[model samples]
Target: MSRAEPKTRPSDPRFSSGPAAKRPGWSAKSLELPSLGRSHRAPLARGRIAHAIELTRTLLEIPADYRIAIVPGSDTGAVEMAMWSLLGPRGVDVLAWEHFGGLWIKDIVDQLRLEDVRVLVGAGDIRHRLTMVDWQRDVVFTWNGTATGTCVPGADWIEYDRQGLAICDATSAIFGEPIPVSKLDVIAFSWQKCLGGEAAHGVLVLSPKAVERLLSYTPPWPMPKLFRMKDSAGLLPGLFSGNTINTVSLLCVEDAIDSMEWAISIGGLSALHQRVRDNYQVVADWVAASPWADFLEAVEPCRSRTSVCLRISDPKIAGLDVAGQHRFTSEIAQRLDNMGAAFDISGFRTAPPSLRIWCGPTVETNNLKALMPWLDWAFAEQELHLHQHS
Candidate 1:
């Protein structure tokens, strides 16, 4: 038996899709000294959070009227806070393309037990035909479906004058893409993903309308202390400003600020978008040249420029039964990991058997180019193994 070849390069291009690659030269230690284990209610923690919110506004160009808050629980918490607070006042239309959107729909219809829910689901990959439903009702959607590597092209699909709220889960798309703030009422994201910070905290951005709804509407059910946005029949201004119900790590806050500053210094959102687009191009070129691979997305325009999902086209590999195809792809992914050429290139468990790659801003295009050869090598190794077995 021979030992696998050791990787000569950094394994940072692992690209598992979430908790994405951090911005270059980013370090949590760069922030002032403070133990994150301490209570986040401390003055120092509050200041750190305030700074993060300010930077988020600057980087994303959020409207001055809109308020940004560092809330608990990742993007899920932020979105749910918006949902629980605002959904009771109006009907909701949930647009689901992939798993995350599906989860949001489930929460609205099942967990929240909302009776009037309209859902629009597309076929094939999330890039399929998008049927427009009534926008007069509250609309909930993920701006980018991280799992399927698909995204709606801005808020063009939304009707701005409609008497409804637009709630967006932009965990993976925020900062990396262009989002029309005017079209969005409530937006939610986590510190992870495009921001590349720690995973425990969520950021909620509330438009004027969203705030009004929170202040006016009374949810039919009791709300948890953490989820409760309206207490004493008014929106908690402190919750939107700083000092959330629970303490958040000051270090994470500092890291998030650093990431935001980096985004601003490097031409803000435009630079961030260019970086992601460059990364996707690297993968696209690889897919075009490789005989054994192609993107899962049917059309080029609908494909995701952030999370690039690919399918192996080799007949020798695809010729296998469904189970065999899975095993073969799994073996290739494992081999790449064992060699340290990549770490988490395996397709999402819920999605079809296809390779998902992260092409976010933090990922180096050169690194992706270098990794493509390794992927080819890994697949070739798999073919050799299959030949031997046969």
Candidate 2:
């Protein structure tokens, strides 16, 4: 089958990196509001936003004093907003293991043009090295690198007593993992990932310290109207509670709310964590059985439970060098997609060539099971084709 062919329906295993699988029984009709077509300033939109915030707070067990906001531009908006607002006041340290964390390091060191910035990057499979850095500086990192399938185990690596604030981009890891609330000062996520809601909106959670940073310190650069979090300070009582800047899809908001409720009813964070862990095991078992498959993450403990990345390890493929291996892997991914076995399993462009599978809460383990045979079939087909061509 060609890429043009509708290979799989929505009911088929959806393994797309973002806009992941939605929770079972989640429906847009449940969130339908008469004011969906009305201005965002309308009361109905505010009510939906309020309900979403409340549900998120309950599902994640956010602190009573913290504030949550639905912002523009998804996870990127949330992270950039936090960096623009919070990093200039203190020395900043960025911990990078993969693409998302790399973006943060670039923003701090290059985009923001901050003079006092340090970036700690780990090579192949190693999570960011946080040792030897002064805790007095601001810290920014992604809790999970969706591309590399690696993650920081928890906030325990952060210096809880330090004067610095810890900002986390938990877009893919938020609901799937356990993040200790007190350790994080600014937490940002998008609706698309684990929550499996629509794109275009982000959820920003601000600890008291993060709020203080925004209120007290202003970055040297002028902040855009959309990035401005302070104007809503007084209005924030309503902003955090009900008022949202732009109109959100009442349907998407309802879907997110339903997803959160589902998370809670099924056992909250613990259950979600277990689901991700279980999904990882499915991939792990596949890796262990196949000599051509091994986790990209160097350390087992630091490997991500949500995004599970694997490398092909056939001796012939390895003998061909990195470029040949990449070509071989790309061919395999294409074959898998054409056969309706997998979609979007190709490793990210910036990452080393490998297969990256998402093992989030909504992804069924049975789908992963189904995928293994397809992977084996595709690889074998590729090998046969290579032999014929040679």
Candidate 2 Cα misplacement greater than 4 A, ranges: 1-11, 27-35, 124-128, 232-237
Q: Put down candidate 2 lDDT per residue, 105-181, tens digits, no spaces.
A: 88888788999888788575443376645689988888989888888866666787979998999999999888888
Off by over 4 Å in 1: 1-11, 35-38, 125-129
The local lDDT score (0 to 100) that residue 171 gets in candidate 2 is 95
Per-model RMSD to reference:
2.4, 3.4
CA lDDT, candidate 1, residue 368: 88
How many angstroms is residue 216 displaced in model 2 relative to the true structure, after the best TM-score fit? 1.0
Clashes of each: 0, 0
| Residue pairs in collision within model 1 | none
Model 1 accuracy (lDDT, Cα): 0.81
Clashing pairs in 2: none
Q: How many backbone clashes does candidate 1 have?
A: 0
